[model samples]
Target chain A: MSGYNEYFDKIKLNEEQHQAILDAVKKEEALLSQAAENTKQKSSDTAKIRFMRRAGLIASCAALLALVIIFPLGKRQSMTPANDKIPEADTVMSSDIRSEGADASLSGEKEVRTDAALSPQENIAADPGSIPAPAEEPVASIITDAVIPNTAKSDHAFPEESDRSAAPANEPYECEFAHSIEKSGEETGEEGPVLVEASVSDGLLIFNGKSYRYLEETITDESAFDAGCLAVITVGGDALLDPALLDIRSGMFLYGKEPYDRLYIRLSEDRFLCFVPEDN
Target chain B: MKTAEEMVSAYENMLYRAALSHTGNCEDAQDMVQETFIRWLTKRPVFESDEHEKAWLLRVVINLCRNYVSKKGNRGNAELLDIYPAADPEEQSLIEDVMSLPAKYRDVIYLFYYEGFSTKEIAEILNTRESTVRSQLLRARNMLKGRLEAEL
Candidate 1:
């Protein structure tokens, strides 16, 4: 091929094209070098991160999870003092009605008198203290009543006024929160209504698989709410009392604490079921 | 150690021209030049000598151009025809004629003659045997002689 050297030389690029490629090479070289330096800096920075920093990140995630488990929301967590985890019965249990032997049927089937268990009006006629044998019968009937809230509205079967076991009108709540079990005997709701599973969706709080819309701002973060403890709001001295909760909706939460506030159950950090007390 | 700038200066023209032989256009040729250097900077392969480094750059250029050519409907070098218009008609004819040769022969002829590579060096760059390169060179010369004689 070199026999015609001049002919092959003509195929070689001229000055301008040669210099143009050189200019492009210079431009690309600067970009590549900058990119390489950036990669080196990133690698060095990543290598310099301490092991303790990674450990601290993991520890933070663990702590967040632990806090999520401990606190029942909807009440003020930051404002409510940590020491108030356990509140006095009289201060929080104001205006509640208690019934003993309510869950005695869980022990075995009890023979309840259908006649005496008719209504709240009928239960008031008997001296409940004198008749312990037939009390389980009416209490079991109350459980049957609880199952059918969607069917018929009944006057609250507050344990008979004559029953000595009834807590004072001031003493209402039979607290059964999961947290209170280890600390004290407060969560032992021997006389409380059997709590059924309930969930909140949109504005309606679903209890006993029936939907009832709340009359007020009951839930803040609805996603955090699980099935709340089932309790009926019944008429008390001045306001409707949620028998499941203490009057002071403090460390835990309630849907409504105002008079005639119905169906207030707190399951989460900032969510509740607020129903109109008139509907109950 | 040669700086990246020094390497660019040393190999850019040869790589660009090598790319041009395959692409037959300046824009795609410049693209291959950039791609070859980018691979060199990122891969940072240690070279045994200047010949090894030059051969590596040329091989990358050839590979990049090969990919460009193999793409579907890639017969795109109309701009390359007018690039050397100021040259005399015979010089222009010769450049056009060389590019018009089959790619394998054109590559061997470019390395053997214009770039002044030995058959061994051309073989190393193309990743072929030196004897195969010599045969390719002879065939390319024979083909070029006949074609140019007819056209000129």
Candidate 2:
């Protein structure tokens, strides 16, 4: 391409010049390799960070699940305690009345509560002859054929007098309560109602091998009863009968399994009326 | 497909020659080549073929040299023989004459004569029309011939 071919040949790189360019290229190559290595390291570090984030998310989910499972159990335990604070019995019949009527006075709570701790003799003096006449079929069946929802497992028990004696007042004791407070106090010649007397007349309603007799108590006090009818608690506190019309007065007998975890009334051979209390 | 070292080895001489045509000095040529490779490491552009890859390297070296020349603004300071200091005087004279030309003429001359790139290939490498490369080559050769004859 040039008339100066000889001249072009003369300026060709000598050994030293050739070596110098080669050395520079090699140096640049080394720097470039190091740069490549640094890039790989950066990518690897990013991947590790992503993995750690996933692991952290999983750990957070597990922690949330553990809290969900443990919280309810913890709350239920907090509601209860090692030592009992609740009354062993419901002589005030406040809960029974309260269920039947929302606006009933709490005065009965004070009256029964004072003598709640008293022995049978003291209970007789406190309100001797103060038994609300046991209406053959109370004036009105305030709580009739009322089947408490059976959502929870009932606190099961067989008839045990010791079980009913005294426990924490906060917890309701499901025990073998007597048939009628007045009738039991009468046998002892005491005036007012005390704890019910144990009767195994119709085979003990055995719960966990202990017998629980059905002590049916009806709250029919018109002023005290907002429903203006009667509310009867099945002896075992398993059933209540609330009749919409107070005039239709009929009592339902308690019948269930031997352990009596649930109570059922045989309406007939084919039909069965069953219920579970709310505070099981 | 090429490792960093392989790419450098494969393209270094060609890129060096193109950069030397642009800057006319060994130092600036080396700087251009190194800078081009540094860009390669950073940008890592995708290439369709080996020709595309080589064209990319050549383009980068040429651009870097062009930028170096404009920033330096002392194009005449480089005497080709003095830049490399060849052991042979005739080669020195010829290279000095080539370097003395304007960068546009020098690029055509280098790619056409020394590198044996066709007018069309040189045009593609320099991003110019083949006709422009042809005219530049003719002008470079005429200038070189006149200078050599006078020196003789």
Candidate 3:
């Protein structure tokens, strides 16, 4: 073992080799330190990028939330009319007119008699304490027109006839009807006109279980009608003698003469009826 | 933990000699020693005593040399004798014989004879059982004895 020790002990590095190892160790340490510093710098850059991305996402979300909150309020503000702030009497009169329009058939005769007994100005003068006079002439005229029935205003049954004689010959009379479809047939029975079921299918109007080709020019707009409802067919504002059926869903009213006469149907606020000719 | 210069100065020669015996070449042995020091610098292992530090360095160098030899499939270089020539013919012959031994045998012999480690300490350094180290030592000795006797 001593002999083996002596042999192994003889093996030693020269001065040059020892210096080379020291130099290599120094070089490696520098490289490692530089690598660690670069890694730390990369980590910092990554963290900054992540923070900016998160901030951008948060900002986008906040902008969307602000739009969501503001949009509905803007719409509501636009919906309210600027001229809605009227006097108390005008407001009451407008409300009464709307109620009368709702139940016009039941109480229409009584309102017409009252309006006939006293003029708008005479009524305000006679019952100055109970009824206040309208501040404006246009407002007073609107109240008179709403209260007075078409039959009371003229001898003719239809208001369009009176409108043609009173107003300019070129101007057309526009009638604004109530937003209700009255089922007259079942309720009135034999006393009044019977309104049967009606439908429009494939460019043909199915009325009283008979298909009739309606005038194409009369159909100003295409409106879909619902089922299981009764409607009356009116000619020159008068119900047909045979009592034709019409499906008046969506507050629709079908009127006008047949056999090439103009038909009027009111479906929506912006849309009106297309007439059906008697020949078709 | 010691600085690179301190570690290199303290254990470089010892590690180099052990690496040389396992690697069988001066260039590979120096490379193994340098790599061992680099690891020591990077790892910064704490030691209780000088012996513990020396043992740790020797184990690292020996393991590095083993890995180099395994990867390169290098047995022994004939030029090993030229690097450090002995004064006596017999001592030179003994060195050659020791180098000629298997890597495991040479490791146990170097730690036991040159480093003055017990069989148990040699096993711990080599990460083997003490009985295995003892058996390897005995077999290495018998092979050396036979070669020396034949030469004589």
Candidate with maximal DockQ: 3
| Tens-digit per-residue lDDT, B1-152, candidate 1 | 77667876777677877877778777788778877877887788999988788888888999888888888335655566666342466666666667778778778877777778899999888888999999998887788789888986
- At residue B106, candidate 3 shows an lDDT of 87
Q: What's the TM-score of each model vs. the native? A: 0.41, 0.48, 0.52
Interface RMSD of 2: 4.8
Please give the distance, in angstroms, between residue A33's alpha carbon in candidate 2 and its true position after superposition.
4.5
As for model 2, its CA RMSD to the true structure in angstroms is 16.1
Interface root-mean-square deviation, each candidate: 4.4, 4.8, 1.4
Please give the distance, in angstroms, between residue A170's alpha carbon in candidate 2 and its true position after superposition.
Answer: 5.1
Report the lDDT tens digits of candidate 2 across residue range A1-280: 4433343344344455446656765676677779789889988999899989999999999889889888988756644531121122332233433332222123242233222234445644667554444435432232334333223224433224443232122233332222323232333466432344322223133322233323322123313322211223343232333211111111222322111223332222222212222121
Badly placed stretches (over 4 Å) of model 1 are A1-45, A53-280, B72-78, B85-92, B148-152
lDDT of 1 at A141: 39
* Order by TM-score, highest first: 3, 2, 1
TM-score of candidate 2 against the unseen true structure: 0.48
- Report the Cα lDDT for residue A153, model 1: 19
Top candidate (lDDT): 3
Per-residue lDDT for A92 in model 1?
31
Clashes of each: 9, 23, 2
C-alpha lDDT values of all predictions? 0.52, 0.52, 0.58
Q: Which stretches in model 2 have alpha-carbon errors above 4 Å?
A: A3-43, A73-280, B2-11, B41-53, B75-78, B83-96, B142-152
- Candidate 1 clashing pairs? A73-A268, A73-A269, A73-A270, A74-A269, A74-A270, A92-A247, A96-A172, A112-A137, A240-A260
Which 10 residues in a row give candidate 2 chain A its minimum summed lDDT? A243-252
